[model samples]
Target: MRERVDKLKEEVCTLFTPSKDMLRRMYLVDEIVHLGIDHLFEKEIETALKDIHESEFASSNLYEVALRFRLLRERGFWVSPDVFQKFKGDDGNFLNELADDPRGLLSLYNAAHLFIHGELELEETISFARNHLESMIRDSVVKGPLADQVKRALRLPLPRTLKRVEMLHYMFEYDQDNGHNPVLLELAKMDFNLLQQVHLKELKEISSAILDDTYDVYAFSSIDECRTLNAAIQGWDDTAISLVPEYLRKFYEIMLSTFREFEDQMPSNKRYLVAFNKAEAAEWPHRNYKPSFSEQVALATETTGVRSLAAGVMLGMSDAATTREAFEWAVTSTDAIISCAKIGRFMNDISGYKVTVDVAIAKINELMEDEWKTTNRARIDNQAVIPVTQRLINLTMAIPLFYGYDSDGFTFGEQLREILENLYVKPMPI
Candidate 1:
């Protein structure tokens, strides 16, 4: 398998040679990323994209133009949204004739999603692309592979969707494309299966542990109960276990045992960073507090669990990749971490909350887009090692999969069952 992967990697890299057309190379780059094997060809991809960027590439085709724009911006290269002005007409709107090209519309739709603040061209472009693409789907003009791509993008654009879940979806779609490279497809399948086994093994290691909600189980009536519970967690010693109610003692003991297990594997100095103050996290809700929107966002940042998850992820990585400074950065409330937490919290709230007004939901969506821009900026500016940074990116991207647009995948397992099964249960056909 290792030898096969090496040969496949070499073949894929060759496809990036200067002889390949810019459009085809960009398409291959997109496919490799969607297939979740871009990491294997980082140098090849960077070289290809760097050449593309430096070439002053331009195309009359909307699909080619939009694809170039998105791929460049996604790689932290700043290609202005102004490149799209050519597609518009005299009335300051996207030309109606462009609607005939469903493929281009879909590409533009996906590209527009990468827009940051005040890029009204992309804002307009997205609205234009969406209306036309939905019309195409309604009219049944796009079929097969194209239709599948359209419908999926409409449901959730590529930028916001979870990487692993999107990879599975794209694998099936890529298989249907007549132009699909057999080597790339085979490599993707083998790589996915190999990683799936590793993930399944990790899952089996902790399969027996089931945690019940401590607050719900205790039915604590007052803030004092929460405070007492929090105090016990802070002590992190056997004597502290006696502070909580007798009924809660067993649960507390089990929790401490788990924390200690984690501590055992982690460096002693780093163990102090792995705190989980569930009791304090629930204080706002226990008091029935109705904070202003800003206050709510602030509160959500600390309680979203992203900070703890980030710390855990960093600690689990190699000490070389996760330096002491990197760990400190993870624990601190940096803009990147804060944006990720806000994105996750807002996504979860939007999924579960029963908001009657469309405007209110729109506001939340707008906030999420803003947070994404902040995240994108942070991604470009981050100084951490590539592995550590990619893990953080994966954590941020997984938020949407956890709490989907219409349903909370975390609270309701049904929505995520198929995705989880694809990742852990179903074997990729080799």
Candidate 2:
């Protein structure tokens, strides 16, 4: 039974040997540090080090060499806490001397470690990262202890890629502030190329996240921030904007569509209605009300109503009024009728006439022809007089075509057709 247990243990160890070898070769000690394994299994690390030194495969010197290299590359120092009783020595200037050498690789490595480990905040780290990045960009070579360290840091997921992109964008803004337009342009090109390689979906999500974070900032931020964003978007290609999520595009379209609908429903003379019912029914609250003859005459006099009527005629509502003069007259007459109805409603409130149809008609006509002599002759003839007379005649002729309702002078069919024809026009083909 003991032999079987030993065999099982040996098989498990062999199975994990390849992974352990890879971890050692990759110098994944930093990864283990990030995982907090040092604190969790301190004894295990010590036992491993002891075994490495004892084994023929690894000499005592080999363990010390490996430890020295890791410390030099990652920590920017070769002092082993076990061996160095006092790394600083009696002279505090030793550390200062280490940093003074321009060609010193240890100094660069130390600076990078300080920057990546959050020993420096955003502002400080940005400067540090920028210096190292600039050095690489200018010379394409990193020398000294810091060279391999900085290169490895860049390859590692130390600073998130998205945050790095944001930092670059911020640098462009800084360049703009300093009037360094050429550098700003180069930075923009670099950022664009980097962003283009990112997955389209990821780019959209990241942009949206950025927008959301800046929403309130843009709304209340200095005008410069808003201007900068606008400029950035303008500088970008339309293809980049096209990559925005479809749902957001749809949202903008719906808003524009709503604006157009309100514009259509509003009376031209009045300030457009601020509120409109969106219900899609053709009855009651949603239904358009047809004005009576008196109401029509009143509308023609209201400035906004008159303008709206003119627009309606231009839209081809008047079949008989082909000429421009006739069309203008038709619109003016329609405006006057609407005005008359409004006035009638007002008078009813004041004098309490009960506003019967006959009384309303008389009021409308009285207002229409009251200044007949002073009216523009050509305008009155083509617009007001002719259009009204023709419309009335058309209604009279259509009486036989319609059935039911003979209480009024005009038949129901004639009245209904006149109202329907005025309010609705067939949609134009796309």
Q: Each model's TM-score, in the order given? A: 0.86, 0.20
lDDT for each residue of candidate 2 in 1-430, tens digit (9 for 90 to 100): 3344344334423322333353252233322232222232333443443333333332223223333333232322222222221222464212333223332323233223222221233223234444555466358565643444455344321221122222322333434344433322343343334333444445455321123213223324333443343333333334433433443444334434443544444446443211111011111222355556544333323422334333343343345435655544544444333433243334322233234587754664344323221221222233224434333222222322232112221223464465333223221111
User: Best candidate, lDDT-wise?
Assistant: 1
Instruction: Report the alpha-carbon TM-score of model 2 versus the true structure.
Output: 0.20
Q: Point out where model 2 deviates above 4 Å.
A: 1-86, 92-210, 213-430
Give the least accurate 10-residue stretch of model 2, judged by summed lDDT: 273-282
RMSD of 2: 36.2
Error of 2 at 253 (Å): 13
Candidate 1 — which pairs collide?
none
